[model samples]
Every structure is written in C-alpha cells, then in structure tokens.
Target: MKELMKGNEAFAEAAIRAGCRFFAGYPITPQSEVLEYLSRRMPEVGGVFIQSESELAGISMVYGAAAAGFRAMTSSSGPGYSLLQEGISYIASAELPCVVMDVMRYGSGLGDIFTGQSDYWQAVYNGGHGDYRTIVYAPSSVQEMADLTVMAFGKAEERRNPVTILSDASISQMMAPVELPAMACHDPDAPAWALKGKGNGHFKRHTSVMYYMNEYDGYVRAKYEKIEKEDQRWESLETEDAEIVLVAYGISSRICEEAMRSARAQGRRVGLIRPISLYPYPVNAFDGLAPRAFLSVEMSALGQMARDVALACGMRAPVYSMLGGTRLYSCSDVEARIGEILGAAHGAF
Candidate 1:
C-alpha cells in the first residue's frame, strides 16, 4: 500500500525493509530528517542508530558495520558528503557493502541550504580518489527514495561495493504520496559473495590490498569488467520509432517526464530514457534506442552522464545539455528545448 509521506520518511522505511540494521550519520540540512526518522525506527526494529561527530566518522562506522555483514547506510548533504568521501573511498578499496544518501544542496563552496545537482559529478565519478566507482541511484520523488534505498543495498551487496541514493534537497524535503511495496525482511544471505566474517576459522579472510602490484591492477580490472557485465538498468518510454530521445536521470528525469508529456500534447514524438543505475551505464540501451538526436537533462553542470552518453551513442546523435553549477530548469524550459530538438531531428528521419 502507498502512504502520503515526505521523501525522508520513505527513505527510512525503505532501508528498514531492506534489512538495514545499522545506520550511522551526522545531521545536515535537507538530509537530517532521514537520520532523525531512522534514529527512531532502527531501534524499534532491534537495529542500531548512531549519531556520530562528523560525516567522516559516521561513514567509517558504517564501513565497520557493513564489514561485519550487517546492511548499513549513512545520509548527508553536499558538505557532509564531501567529508565522507574519504571514508567512502576506503569502503570502496576495502570492498565493503554500504549505501549512502547524498541529498545534494547547492555548492562549489558553501552554496547554501537550497537544492542543487552539484554533487552529480562527485557521486558517480569519484569524489575521493582512485579508479573506484560506486553505483549511483538517482530518485526523482518520494517513492523512489524508498525503492532506491532497497535497490542501493542490493546493488552494493551484489557488487561488494558502495552504492549511493543520490538526490537534491528538493527531493529530500519534498512531500508526496508514495505507494510503498510490502516490507520484506532483509536477507543477509541474499547476496552470494557477501563477506561474512572469517567463518569460524574455516575460511580465509577478505582483506584489503596491503601490497599493491601489477597483478593487483589486473585483478581489479577483471572485477570491474565483471561489474560492467552484471550491473545495468535504464528505463524507456515509446522509443520504438523515436527520432529524438531525451536522456535524464534522477530528479531531472522526473522533470523530463513531465516535459515529455507536455511536448506530446503539442504533437511532438519525443521520448525519455531514464537510467536507474549510473555507474554501470546502459550503453546498450543507448545503442538500441539509436535516436537521430539525443539531449541530456539533469541537475549538474554537464557532468558524468552526458559524456558517458556521448561515448555510448556516438556522435551520430548530437547531444544537448541543460544542467550545470546553476539552478535547474523547469518543465516548460525543458519541454521547449526537447520540442525543438525533436522537431529538427524528426525532419531528417
């Protein structure tokens, strides 16, 4: 059944349903409600909720708990997310399974307590260091907040890597009616490769790389290659004969959906393709769609996905973008752009 709730409330419920037993976080604007709600709910379900001193410490605590085979998570805004990147990198290198919510707010440096997609580049492209990649799940609404929370944990455990439920404060603070799925108890054993302790001294320990060598590079490469094969999801609408395709993710995609509907009302044949998972990008989906013109709409200033889409779809489809270090455009602004692009491209098709 669905309930009318804030995005933060849905986020907490989803985590609980995903069998998250441990949550550690530092309160920050836009995302504190997630911590507050989980602080109460986690304990009621015989789980753990810890409010740490800083985002750095909070993520470390999550790393520790996840290492012990408990589903765990942490939430923060742009600044706090930056603080946690170091811990996130360590969690990546250690191959620990965990989820992080980045309810992004405006900022290159102290942007403010407002909504912004500035963290798009950081979340998917590596804010901390190294070649590590985290599965980034962008949810546009309250329902996605909860649904993506569960999906994030499952992806993290499956990949033995970090996963992020990336969103802007607009989404975090917004209230919407969201139909939640039936809550299911988390199954720790659902993941096959979950590091489950030393196993009664009968198995070798899963240790972080202490000694780096050429072979380790190859080993990491193989793991990433396997990840590319296994992890990928992108949703589409009416692309069977679409000449112009709109590519968006997270909240921007939600906006794009509204834009698409309006454009259709005006007799445009535009469509939208939403990438549910950003790290293992759906390159094949891009290829299969094969639209004449592709445009990207998002909340960041021309970040990771746009470039990734270009590479996958090739220059055959010219790409236009309307995202940056500025405010996100509205449904009208995006609809007009997509309408123009689709109209121009439709002529050629």
Candidate 2:
C-alpha cells in the first residue's frame, strides 16, 4: 500500500529498507528532514544514526562505518554538500560502497534554501580531488525519492564505490504518495575486503596508495568504462519524431514534459529527454535521433547540463539552454522558450 510521505522522509525510510545500518548527517535546509526522520527511526530498526557536529564529521563517520563493513549513508545540501567533497574523495579512493544524498539548493557558496539544479557538475563530475567517478541518480518525483534510494545502495555495493542521489529542494520537501520497499538486512561481514578483527591472522588489507600502481589505474579505467557502457538510463517522449528536443532532469524535467505535451497538442514537433542517471549520462538516449536542436532546461545561472547534451549529440545539433536559476520554470514558460528557439531556427534558414 502507498502512504503519503514527504520526499526527504521517504528517502530516509527507503534507506532503512535498503539495509543502511549507519547514517551520519548534519542538518541543512531542504534536507534536514532526512536526518530528523532517521534519528527517530534508525533506532527502531536497530540501525545507528548520528546527528554529527558538522558535514565533515558526518561524512567521515560514514566512511568509518562503511570501512567496518556496514551499509552507511549521509545527507546534506548546498555548502554542506560541498564540505563532503574531500571525504567523498577519500571514500572513493578507499573503494568503499556507501550512499550520499545531496539535496541541492540554489546558488554557490552558501546558496539560498531553495531548489536548484546547479550541482550537476559537482555531482556527475568528481568535485572531489580524484580521477574517480560516482554513480549519480536524479529523482524528479517523491516516488523516485524512495525507489532510487534503494537502487543507490545496491549500485554502490555492486560497483564497490560511493553512489550519490542528487535531489533538489523542491523534490526534497514535497509530499506525495509513495509505496516504500520491503525492509531488508545487510551482513557487514559479507564482503571479503571488509575489515575483520585480528582473529584472521597473516592477512591484512589496506585501501590507500593502491591507485599509484600502474595496474590499478587500468582496472579503475576499465571499471568506469564498463559502467558507462551498461548503466546509462533515460526516458524519451516523442523523441523519435522530434524537431526540437528538451533535455532536463529533476524538477526541470517535469516542467519540460508538460511543455512537450502542450506543444504536441498544437502540432509542434517538440519532445523531452529526461535523464535518470547523470554520471554515465544516458548518452545512448541520443542514438539515432537527428533533432535540429537540443535545449537544456535547468535551474542554474549557467546551463550546467548543456555541455553534456552537446557532447552527446556530438555537436550535430545546436544545443540551447533555458536557465531558471533560483526559481522553477512553469509549463507556459517552457512552451514560450521552445517557440522562440523554433522561431530563431526558422529565421536561420
């Protein structure tokens, strides 16, 4: 049965169902509810929850817990998310599998407590100082908030690397009906690489400086390549015959979908491509489509996701940007922008 739940609460409960036994996070706007929800619930399930003194402390706690073989997680927003970058780099280097949720707010350097998609570059690209990449999922609805939290935990373990759920303030605070997943338990000692006590003598494992080895470099490269080839995910609507395709994710994608339907009703050849995975970046979704123009709609001052769309199309089509910054674009707002782009395209010929 589906229950009405806030987005942040849904993510927290979903993490528990996915067997996240240790959660460490500091409070931040638009995402504090995650930590708040976990505080009251983790103990009920015999899981560990810590309201850390800082984002840095929270992420480090997660690292330690994950190293000890527990499924661990952390949540933050904006600057708080920025503070986790260094720890994230360390966790990635250590090859630990854990989950991190960045409920993004607007702007840079202590941005406002409002929804924004500006963290696209930070989440998809490694903001941490490393050559490693984390799998990133962007959820547009409350249902995805629950669904993708479960998937993030599984993908993190399967790939043996940290996974991120990049949500924005709007989705993080909204309330909707969600069917939560079944509860499960994780065995901390299941992984061979996990730290065991001194009882297992003559064998020791270390997680640092292994990347300095030439062979490990090749292994990491191959692993990311495999992920790129196999894990790209997206949703396409009328793209098969679209002349102008709008590329978006998170809340912006929802608006684009509405605009697509509005345009289609009036006989406009508009389409939508909503990316679910940001790291491997659903490049495959662009396959065989020869749209004349690709428009990137995002809530960032600069269209952060436009570059990826341009690269995915191999510059075959001119890519445009519809930036919303601290606000969201309405269906009419998106529809008007599409008409303007189409008008300009017609004038060019």
lDDT of 2 by residue, 1-349 (tens): 9999999999999999999999999989989999889999999989999999999999999988998889999999878988999889888888889899999999998778878988888999978997899999999999998999999998998998899999998899999999999998889989766777748576645465464576887888998999999888888999999999999999899889999999999999998999999988999999999988999999998889999999998988899999988667899999998888888989842
TM-score of model 2 vs. true structure: 0.97
Best by lDDT: 2
Q: Model 1 — which ten-residue stretch has the worst lDDT?
A: 204-213
Residue-wise lDDT of candidate 1 within 307-344, one digit each (tens)? 87788687777988777556668999997777667667
Worst 10 residues of 2 by lDDT: 203-212
Stretches of model 2 off by over 4 angstroms after superposition: 209-214
Candidate 1 residue 267 C-alpha distance from true site, Å: 1.8
Residue 202 accuracy (lDDT) in model 2: 62
lDDT of 2 at 92: 87
